[model samples]
Target: MGRKQSFTATELLDTTKRLVLEHGYDGFHLKLLSEHLPGARSTIYQYYSNKEEIVAACMKHVIVTVLEQASAVDETDAMSALQQLLLIYVGESQLHQLLGDAYKINTANSPAAANDLEFVEQAHLTLKSQLTRLFERAQQDKKLRNDIPLPVLVGVFFNLINTPNMLNIPTPQWSELLFQMWIGGARS
Candidate 1:
């Protein structure tokens, strides 16, 4: 047998994310990944049962970073935390867009879908709760408008943050504008 290829799970996920973004979920294949990396297809299969599992794993990798940034926020400073989280959301917009594209394509329906869906639901709930609490605090402090319900407000912010590609605006400018338009009132 040939010597085993040495690689870390992080390296695999990083390469997977890059490949998925370049090829999209439908165009992405395990063979392509194996060809792109220095490992054998069997090595990849050892870590992930299929391409779908790797895609899900890559998303989870990104979600972990989002949560870590949110966790680093000080409890007393909700607005600041919220801003940081929004920036994080913008930073990951390409990954989010890739996931969106993946969902649209009818490809690679692996058994891992159920687990991935569950994990995504939980992560979304966690992120939503954190956002809702911050908006609630901001509302209480008269920093945000109370006319919009918290859930709707959170949804709007989430939708907006994921729209880096749609907006046609520069990232830094778009982020600042997003914060100002969503969190800070237009008049402010």
Candidate 2:
């Protein structure tokens, strides 16, 4: 039988995600990725043809995870669901920054990369729809203030993902604190 692979796809993708977030799409390169991985540089090629493919695959992997977790959230209590969803989004906050560089990826030569980007786009729409649904439900249930426009509230909620965790608190508590601040305001 052929020799076993030194690293799994998840490991490679996870490393790719970290590097991309650290270096950005413009700074990220296959050479840098190989430096952090366990196997030889050629091994990366075996998994992905080029940087575009790898980065696109990494983006797709992240959004897919967020999509899964967001979908699993129960909507019976819209406000509760929004809190949980915020936690999920905060956990993968890097995804928002990563997706911002998606347009820089040239998919002309790589169908796999193109397909992965397409999935990312579709998954983004799905997540947006879910968030909108929850917000509307919450507003209808009178859980949220009716004065502010839904889009404004939704925009602010989404912006919370970018809030700096200056204290480096754990994700669970950080998310909870944010949700509370969003609902209860900063005033004592």
Candidate 3:
């Protein structure tokens, strides 16, 4: 009887994430991945052509999942949406760390760097658009300051949004403090 295959794209991503955490991106090669993946080298290669492609695919998969889930937030107001998003942001922060090693690989090599940047930009823009709407609502409701330019406000929020994950420091009040800062400044 033929053995059932447990590997999948999802499995690939999960494995990739673990490898990134354990081995770092530079340590994630076919020879290393084969040990953890429980599959043939060709199997890994069948799904991914090379290490760069593998990192790109994994990063894209994670960001896409996050954006899709985050975009569905049903909060009625800016503060609520911000709260909802902060919750999600906190969750995503840990996930992003999986890409830390991949990020080093991305930052070093120009050949594959552009693709990683593109995927990250897509994720960034996705969050930016959602925030823009929330900011507009807050402006109309007098919940946020309107004097600041929309792009600048969004940029500030973006900076705060990435802080926890980038530093690997999970402050219990991180999101709360960030939301307060933005809301304090966003209200008109």
Candidate 4:
């Protein structure tokens, strides 16, 4: 076989993620990917039509995992809890990068993402629900001013946290940078 998938889809994603981390997205191309995994181009295509879909799958997998981890953080100080959540999404230990680049790519090109968009939107709604709860708690506890609505906070918070690469900041700076703005909503 010219293409060898020594790894399963999970393994292929892990390898793809590692390759992306090591070489960036441009370095991970369809030809190169199929070459690394043996069988045929069609085999890899069976799992993902393009390299973009593979990247999207890897990201969606991580995001779903992160939300699950944060599910147990039911505290009045949800923003404080977010500091910890931020670690999973943005910290050095982060698996696929803060918000998953391939997911963003698919979303930005939503017509192509139609297959997974419903599931993705549902997942986002769930995360937003969690954030909404946190904001509600914050307002009740008076840690966050009550003027801002939960839906708005959810939108703004997600947009800020989901800014992909911050472009120039050092790796250590991401969580603090994100939280500073996250905590900004609480200002009276």
The most accurate candidate by lDDT is 2
Backbone clashes counted, model 1: 0
Candidate 2 at residue 39, lDDT?
Answer: 63
Q: In model 1, state the lDDT of residue 145.
A: 80
TM-score attained by model 3: 0.66
| Candidate 1, lDDT over the whole model | 0.76
Location of the lowest summed lDDT over 10 successive residues in candidate 2: 1-10
Q: Model 2: per-residue lDDT, tens digit, 1-188?
A: 66644788899999999999999999999999989987679999888999999999999999999999999999899999999999999999988889999999999999999999999999999999998999999889899998999999998898888899988999999999899999988999
Off by over 4 Å in 4: 1-5, 15-29, 35-56, 92-115, 147-188
Judge candidate 3 against the unseen true structure and give its global Cα lDDT, from 0 to 1: 0.71
TM-score each candidate. 0.76, 0.95, 0.66, 0.57
Clashing pairs in 3: 143-187, 144-186, 144-187, 144-188, 145-186, 145-187, 145-188
Query: Residue 17 error for model 1, in Å?
Result: 1.4
Pairs in clash, predicted candidate 4: 3-37, 3-38, 3-39, 4-37, 4-38, 5-38
lDDT of 4 by residue, 1-188 (tens): 35354447886776666666666666767777666665666777667777667766766666667668777665546678766666555643445352344544545544444545455557767866776677787778887768877677666655655566646676447767777867774667
User: For candidate 2, what is the lDDT?
Assistant: 0.93
Once fitted onto the true fold, the runs of candidate 1 whose alpha carbons sit more than 4 angstroms away are 1-5, 101-113, 163-174, 184-188
- Candidate ranking under lDDT, highest first, comes to 2, 1, 3, 4
Q: Model 4, residue 183: what's the lDDT?
A: 79
Model 4 TM-score on a 0 to 1 scale: 0.57
Every candidate's lDDT? 0.76, 0.93, 0.71, 0.64
